[model samples]
Target: VKSGAGYLPVDPSYPADRVEFMLADAAPVAAISWSGRELVLPAGLPVVDIDAVDVSEFDGSVVSDADRVAPLRSSNVAYVIYTSGSTGRPKGVQVPHTTVAKLFANTESVYGFDESDVWTMFHSYAFDFSVWELWGPLLYGGTLVVVDYVTSRSPEQFLELLAAERVTVLNQTPSAFYQLAEADRLASESGRAAELSLRWVVFGGEALELRRLSDWYGRRGDFAPTLVNMYGITETTVHVSHRVLDAALVADASASVVGQAISGLQVFVLDTRLAPVPVGVAGEMYVSGVQLARGYLGQAGLTSTRFVANPFNAGEVLYRTGDVASWNSAGDLEYLGRADDQVKIRGFRIEIGEIESAVLADVSVAQTAV
Candidate 1:
């Protein structure tokens, strides 16, 4: 029977027909529901019902009749995550299972995953960041504390969850972290703050301002969590480069750099010609290696353009991150701005060109530039 790392079904409240159709399209060998829903097998595929199955209940005796054979297929379709239909319609990004595993392994290598680390899964299940936040810890047998929507929306509850869960490794957007820091909630909960086991906190989905992160850490004491500023695009899974922020680096007046590429990945600041730009000169960043996704789902044209053959490596593909960045004297990477019109606002990456193309439909302005 076909299956994946886990048998997590989509939200039960969603249309069952749509969910079934989606599962059929994805062609999973088995299905599991969070609720105790009876399984009605699809026409040809064998199915396993994991309804109400807790982590402790792994006995195969329940589904003794189910086929236990492993299915063989290309690793190119582990996650078929649909993007928000902001431009026209939602399109799925088919990421390889191998890429997902590599990204998770890379994350663990960077943060040193351990049983002592308790991660709070913040992002929606649909978001790719959730892949790292959800599976990365579980991959290493670390504890995962799922954060509810209400707690994510409220600043007070956000801090309280960290303390209550004793979250060690947390990742969030700059805006959300800023909100939690700006609020005086942590001040009143001294006991809770003292209990915080936060070892590392990562910021991504937007350019993390060092001053803002420092200010937040300063509000607490030196014993507070170490902040990690990560940078990467979705096509590369989650993160490509990350820099750990310590009290000394935070106190430095100069802008902190994004640091070198993580192990197993190669990062290059290339010019329009795709040639490596000289040190200190700004150029578009390109990432190549196992962490890169196979391609965008059903958008071969778009995929072909962004995911191109690695200029240096004969058989490799590199994801062209249209971000203008440069290397500092210390060999750290520093982001300047977007090489294209795309901007990151409130954590969502918005392509200005796409917006402008849509606005051109309206006859309001004679000339426009996004």
Candidate 2:
């Protein structure tokens, strides 16, 4: 994605037919794949087998500025990420360079990111969470530790990797972090818990259960690896608001407060009529500012429905997040349940309707429900 090309990432686990559908929708210029992976590329799209070429064989020649492809502008499409569709087919979201660039523009002050940090690419490339993991480090001259699919699946192996690599910054879904915290508990009991160098633990992609970290914090304490919970959506880049969690806040039984908006973004809890709801009253969230995506790819109707013109700003637009939230007494936004049936499991957003549709596709199935 850092190159001047806009690419679509496909999960290797996807069925061939599903892959074909995505390829047909995006109509990318070319496809790149690992040499050994069995992939069915679109009929005419060129395939670049990464492992087939040897870089040492080439004379290290640099392209002249005149001959090089022009650098992409901030408005250019950076990537297209597909979201689970309420309809039968998934819809892709076209994210521009400026939207992504804004995610990290002034985040260093809050997160304290620097070249000294060692980050891990823990999530799948197909997931938007991986965008921050992959680029945040490289863009700032920090080392990015890549974990294989197998290691990522096993919490024990993942913890081992984190200790071995001395990863300083860690990002995880609350579900995955729960497993890792359990593994840490087991390791601690056996007197084998590896000493870790993690300085920041950023959680996102799902609603966080603060109590889930009680055991992990019991071992590591509240100082090292400052814990942060971020509330975000793919449509609004990676994150919108961040809450720095401590033991005192975690012990509180009230709703999870997802702290104030990040730099260059505005968040509002509005009623059905787009009017701001009173504090402590639940309402649909509408996010504004530069972080918003251009809109859903090839989904004009859905885009128009969700991305409405900003009433406060003449030329700007706001993204209607189906999530319901309200302002707490502390001025932080507290998460309520989804306004719709969209559910997040293991950090992947799943539309229950989509699951029902897939189940009904079976030949023998007369009817199905999720």
Candidate 3:
């Protein structure tokens, strides 16, 4: 948004039909693409190939003139991130500049991001997790090593990249980390372990079963490269709650413990009527505060249903997350998966995540889908 233009990151690997559908929904004025990629765009949609941009001939001093300025407002929409809808089509979420700034502004102390760190941009820009992975280093003047597709797919290769680049901050999904941990174990057992410089490994995009990391903890421990599980969604500006995973919590935590809301944001577990549920009671999750997205773009009806007026506040709004959660006795929130993600078995309802967690608890189980 440096040039006051928002970006809608389309998955480079999406099929032509899928790409066209996203283009129609976002209605971006122009598409920006890098070299060596085939893009399918709507009719007459302006496309700019960044590889062909010849800005080298331009005088840097003139374009970088100190007086030449157009400041961006905090309310200005920074990007449009599309999230999957129940109807199959994706709905674009309008995230403002302020919403993004609010995330780091409140959690900078907790994250301890700085200029000395080196991060790897591993996830696709289309995924909201990439927002955290991309901006964390740039905003702090830190170095960012872009992971190639080949390396991203292989845990052994990724581990090699981390050691070669001396990457300090890493973000990954638990599923991906499982293999990497296994690779680390193998390397250690073979007496060929690569020295890692990671200081933090942030997890998101799914519920993390801490018990699965027993072997990893036994090897690396929890003190270094502090492992944190951040519960997040695209509409809520990436993260809703932050929980540092420790040996004690890993052994005791039954469900995914998302911990508490970051400083500026407010997350409440409320009943169907929007009334706050008592401690340890499961209910739908609602988020309120500055980080909330503007709403689903061009989908007024859908926006109204998802983002409703806050019952506790006079004129504020809350984004109904459709997530099931409850507060623990320690006042920390525990994520119980999506509210609508239940399966009926012989007239009894069971959350799919609960079953998945049980299956994952098996030491021999590598992955599961139920």
Candidate 4:
């Protein structure tokens, strides 16, 4: 990321057909993967196997003036993350360097990320959550511990690994964190609870279940590693708002509180006509800020439909989040649910219509409903 070269991360667990589709969508200059792994990449696309060549063979090399790399600008594309499209294809969201940078701007002051911290890269590289997990530590001069897929799936083992690695900052989806919290509870009951070094627990990728955190708080109390829940989207570049949870906040289950907007972004709960709704009234969410993505790649119509011009600010655009939310009496945005059929289960946004359409494509099936 520091080299200013845009990269498209492909999930290793994705099927060959999905991988092929992503490769076609991104149209990357070259593909890189581990040596000996047979990947179904686009035909004629150059493949760079990182393990196939020895880096020591090309030491002390410098590019000449003619071959010098161009200076990177903030507007340059940083990466492309593909999200499942309602049209039965995945659409790539082109995020610029400025957008990603805005996420970390002044975050250190608020979150206290420093060189002494040790963070874990817990999410899949293809997932937008990994954008923060992978770079947050690196940008802050902290060590990033990588968790393997197998270990990550097993909550008990993952907890043991976190303790062994002395991870200070942990980022997890609410669903995944619940599993870890359960594992910790079991360990505590068995009189074998490991002493962890975690100082911060940041939750994202899904709506946090405040009730599910009772077990964790019962064991660790309210202060040890501060728990924070953030609500975000891929098009908004990651997180827009974050709520720092405490014993009082978690116990008060009045609403799906997702906290207030972070720096560099604005969140609006608007009516169907795109006008701001009164406080305490449910409305669709519209986000406008520096962190907004450029737009969906090769999807001008979809982009236009979702990202509309901001009437308040000339030449500025706002992304229609399609999430039903409202400003509660407490002055925090409370998430109600999706405005449409988009379901967020276990951190994955799934369109029910898309699945139904896929099932209907089979010749044997006359009709189907999701």
Models, CA RMSD each:
5.3, 1.9, 7.6, 1.9
Looking at model 3, the pairs that clash are none
lDDT of 2 by residue, 1-370 (tens): 5456777989978878778888899889888887897777877888888888677975566544444478557888899999888776888999998888889994767986889999999998989999899889988899999999899999999999999999999999998999999999999999998899999999999888787777777888898889999999999998999989888888773776788899899999999999999989999999998889988888899999999999988999999999999998888988887998899988888888888888889999999777
Give the range where candidate 3 is weakest over 10 consecutive residues by summed lDDT.
342-351
lDDT string, candidate 4, 232-301, tens digits: 9999988989888987778877666899889888999999888999988999999998999989888899
lDDT string, candidate 1, 222-241, tens digits: 55677878887778878899
* Model 4, global lDDT: 0.87
Ranking by lDDT: 2, 4, 3, 1
TM-score for each candidate, following the candidate numbering: 0.79, 0.95, 0.88, 0.95
Local lDDT at 183 for model 1: 56
lDDT (0 to 1) per candidate: 0.72, 0.88, 0.84, 0.87
User: lDDT tens string, model 3, 103-125?
Assistant: 88878979878999999998888
Task: Report how far residue 325 has shifted in candidate 4, in Å.
Answer: 0.7
Error of 1 at 222 (Å): 4.7
Runs in model 1 with CA error above 4 Å? 1-70, 73-76, 84-90, 184-194, 221-223, 253-256, 353-370
Find the candidate with the highest TM-score and give its number: 4
For model 2, give the 10-residue run with minimal summed lDDT.
59-68
> How far does residue 228 in candidate 1 sit from its true spot (Å)?
1.0
